[model samples]
Target: KLSKRYDCVVMEDLNMKGMSQALNFGKSVADNAWGMFTTFLRYKLEEQGKRLIKIDKWFPSSKTCSCCGQVKAELSLSERTFQCECGFTADRDHNASINIKREGLRLLA
Candidate 1:
């Protein structure tokens, strides 16, 4: 469905093994089947001549201000809101998503 609907798909190349090892919810992370899902998505996209771009896991998607391009040195997991010095504030996830989308487009260009 994704391959047919979209010309390109962008995803983060997460370090699942490292995360599972570091976190207490190892079983939950392993059970989420992210690796399997990405593998299947890759194959399906290739079969349909669609593109799948995986951004680096280390990319500071959540730390950078989406509006001003300023990167913060530290952002704790407990901080659900992303507040930048430039006065741009947004939900952390939403801000990260915007950054990811911009990076994906940059890569495509």
Candidate 2:
């Protein structure tokens, strides 16, 4: 579905294993099979002549406001929503996704 709908997919190159060990959410993180999913998705995208762009893990997507471009100094994982002094607010993950996609496009360009 993704291959047909989009020519490119953007994502963060996260360290899930490190997160699992450090954060002590091994069961939850490992159960997601993110690595397998990523591998398969890459293969499928390649097969369909699509592309998958993975940005660096430390790109500060969540810490940067997607609307006003304000970069926060700190953003906790528990803070499910992102708020900026510029009056920009959005779900943290959603904002991050937008940033990731924009960065990916920039990389391609």
Best by TM-score: 1
Candidate 1 C-alpha lDDT tens digits along 24-92: 667888889899999999899999988899999999999999999999999998999999999999999
Model 1 compared with the native: what TM-score?
0.94
lDDT of 1 at 11: 79
Model 1 residue runs over 4 Å out of place are: none
lDDT of 2 at 70: 83
**Candidate 2 residue lDDT tens string, 39-80:** 998999999999999999999999999998889998888999
Q: How well does candidate 1 score on lDDT at residue 18?
A: 82
Mark the regions of model 2 whose C-alpha exceeds 4 Å error after superposition. none
